[model samples]
Target: MRGTLVLISLALVVAGVVLLRSKRPAWYWMTFGALVALVRIAFTYNSVMEACGLTVPPSRLRLMLARMARREVPPDRPPRLLRTRVTRTGLVLRLGLRPGQDAFDVAASTDRLRHSFRAYGVTSRELRAGVVELRMTGYDVLKRVQMPAKTERDVMRVPVALRDDGSIQYRDYRQIPHALNLGATQSGKSVYQRNLVKELAPQRVALVGIDCKQAVELAPLARRFSALADNPDDAVLLLEALVGRMVSTFHVIRREQRISADIPDAEITADIWGLPDKLRPVPVVVVIDEVAELALWANTMEKKRRDRIITALVRLAQLGRAAGIYLEVCGQRFGSELGDGITMLRAQLTGRTSHRVNDEASAKMAFGDISPDAVLSVQAISAERPGTAIVGDYSGGWYRTRTPHTTLRQAVTTCNDTAYLTPDLPELAAFRPVLPPLTPAGPPSLIKPRPRPVTE
Candidate 1:
């Protein structure tokens, strides 16, 4: 007994030292968890089975796993634990599946696993053939925003937000040339766009904005924008100007594709990146806020104007990648209700994000093609969770993510700071509205009173 007392005291001292040295809260939780583990181990096979939600006369093989885990070692059968890995987030137990058991069985039991382990959440993924991985989140990771540090220097890839799994969510403009972002009002959709622009501002790319809502969203960042269109008329002109630039860029690419006497035929290419640095045209990112506005029209004349704008955007989305132009189309609702060609434009937007939408229909508009589960997930995002969203791509791998709250002032400052980086596109310059240079305020006209006194 005296020896055991000494051992306990020594263990306490070691734990104290370790906790002092570690910065993460996992250490503190694990110290208490060690005590809980002792109590958990004392539970009988029946009790463990009941706690794991297998009380209703579960299969023999399932009980075998339970007993084996508790070292009960059933007289009839025993399952094996190949390996166990404990991470800061959760534990991974690798167990051999029985004849009828599969990864789906494990996945289906995630809720029960969470309850049994007293974890916040539990998820399972197939590691390989016949092997499954259960990833449990240690805490409510989405409660606090996980801001991504600026690391990517390439204009083609920007770290826009953080995933619930602690991975950086990258908006790779190179891979996904067009994206569809949907969110209801106050659903944190605008915050995600702010984060995207904040990251893109420092890169070598021209920014064009179309905000039919009187530029309330994108106007503040005009210093960094190469073109700004707040009305449909201007939007039409701006889009046409972009199409003109696309044609010019294609011409440049085609001209550069010619093989020189010194160069091999294998080196010939058609993309903008293939061209030499001096000859290469600048990459452009066009942001359209409330794309539904551009698709909706009342009369024939308005319909014609709207059609022109929509057609331009569709063509850009379909053929802009090779020409170094990308689109980030955002809206509250985007569906057949908008108008014709909207579906085709949405089809081109491979990257989709749906925030806390107002209705299930909006969620379906964003994610129905990808996964019905994704649509359900997005629709469930509560209004309280503003920045939370369901983000997915054409790859069909979707996940819940959240962007940190970036204020309008922060976004404006980012653009102002990086305003010098806006690339000059000759075709776009004609459509870009000119603003007078900033002149510092002088003390309110000291000489203005002299003219007024003479008139009096």
Candidate 2:
């Protein structure tokens, strides 16, 4: 209505200038439009707050507090809003907890708050000693792509996707060396991988891939990979080779360490990061697609091979960080039931992202122990919302997030463009697979032309 009034007012002004030759009525209409907009906001503000249960009438608060202080049975005193910080995305409400209220109470009421306000989503966090922060997302943040702003290059930080708050979420592989990205088939899991791979392609890093599924997902991006393994046998070999590299890297670190007069003994280094740039080993990012296929066993022989693979990966997870090796483990579902060492592997993966899943169990497998609330958030993601996910870290920081749509062709093109930039890793040269080019579609030529050429 306000927009319509504004348009009508503009039309009236144009008519007065062109036809009537009188500006008086045009000014009146413009004033009316402005008033309508202000009045609409004023009228809806109170009702919107009331509907969201955000407004606390002073009389009701006093009565409720009095009853609670008098030892009422329920003791249902509502939390008082202390203040709010408005931002472009939404407002952050800071609430003062009542006698028996806590941060969890506000967090538990997020569903109700979301429904009442008709908001896209709501999240809560604890602030200052006793305050609870309720961050309400006012709009559908995941409806479009939220690209990251360009900043100075930081090799350790790779911008992955956008959080609901419009801030870029980075995968700090240097700090969190390993990550577990979980989502069902076509749940935008591959898109996340594409973002990571494309971002890392030009960096001074070695890319290695283990795709046990159809091999179509990572195979196309092989131009950027230092080594590519399509089956379990090759995966085992590649993993073992990585383990050798890790041991050798540690050996170099030990040899390079020296007790300097100015440097403290505690600051002595044992990682490739401590070495000079020219002398530092090229960092390796190991991508494992469908880790479950590598873990699942079919026969005695397969079980042994799986055990070796798991042990190698466990060692990599435990000690690979200092050696400048990182893992990006992608799978549909990850759980303790997968195998013996699966739980150990998961514990090392501090960063987790769970996209749309077929069941709550899969979501829990990714974040249950880390944060139960994150599991609920992941459960709320419908099948229609493929890219929507819950991302969290070991510090209990979790939020709803989504990656932008990146086609397979784009990802492949990115890899191809940066293929010439792939760093040489002497340790992985033997394991690198040289894939054969696609054969032509036509039949082979006959050998009947040899006699005619000789006669000529």
Best model per TM-score: 1
| Per-residue alpha-carbon lDDT of candidate 2 for residues 349-427, written as tens digits (9 for 90 to 100) | 9889988888989988888889888989898987776688899988877988888888888887777767666666777
| TM-score of candidate 2 relative to the true fold | 0.74
TM-scores for all candidates: the values are 0.76, 0.74
Which residue runs of candidate 2 sit more than 4 Å off their true CA positions?
Answer: 1-88, 91-119, 124-134, 148-153, 260-262, 265-267, 433-456
Error of 2 at 16 (Å): 23
Residues 213-249, candidate 1: write the lDDT tens digits: 9998988888889988898988998999899889988
In model 1, residue pairs whose N, Cα or C atoms come closer than 3 Å (at least 3 residues apart or on different chains), thus clashing, are none
**Residue runs of model 1 more than 4 Å from their true location after superposition:** 1-106, 126-133, 148-153, 259-266, 436-456
